[model samples]
Target: MFFKRPTKEVERERNQRLLEAVYSTKASWDHARETERAVYEANVNSELHYRSRIQEQKFLYLYKIARKFKVHGKLNDGVIDR
Candidate 1:
């Protein structure tokens, strides 16, 4: 059956298929962008949390060192007084 289909029907079918493809592609792109955005936000939050913990540890360590120095200084002063 080599009879060519009507031009109007052929054009309508082609346009419909194209529209469907466009919609599908757009949906997939949107989903990928959302996933990427979510992953980036998670990574940023993780980094901030890690940095906060490190800073807290550093503060505690420094506080302990300062306390030791203060105690050592008091001992030295007492010995000198004697």
Candidate 2:
């Protein structure tokens, strides 16, 4: 049926959006973590301070991403959960 077909497509599209949003936000968080470690090791006082702020920003973004993912559907937040 035409309605059935459209419904499937709609679900598929919805899934794609949710997946993309989740993955992209996760990647951003990972990058931030990497930066945090790299900066911490650098031993540069000023940059380390900046990195602290960056780390906080990244965490805030990560929270938003998790909320977004939850809004779409209840997905496993493995690291965040632990």
Runs off by more than 4 Å, candidate 1: 1-6, 42-82
Give the alpha carbon lDDT tens digit for every residue of 1-82 in model 1.
5887658777666555554444455455555455556677556546544544555555455446545433221133535764
Reference-based TM-score of each model: 0.43, 0.45
The TM-score between candidate 2 and the true structure equals 0.45
Which residue ranges in model 2 land beyond 4 Å of their true spot? Answer: 1-6, 42-82
Where does candidate 1 clash, by residue pair? none
Candidate 2 deviation (Cα RMSD): 6.5
Over 1-82, each residue of candidate 2 has an lDDT whose tens digit, in order, gives: 5555446677668667766666666566677667677777767567655655665675666567556645354556773764
Quote the positional error of residue 19 for candidate 2 in Å.
Answer: 0.5
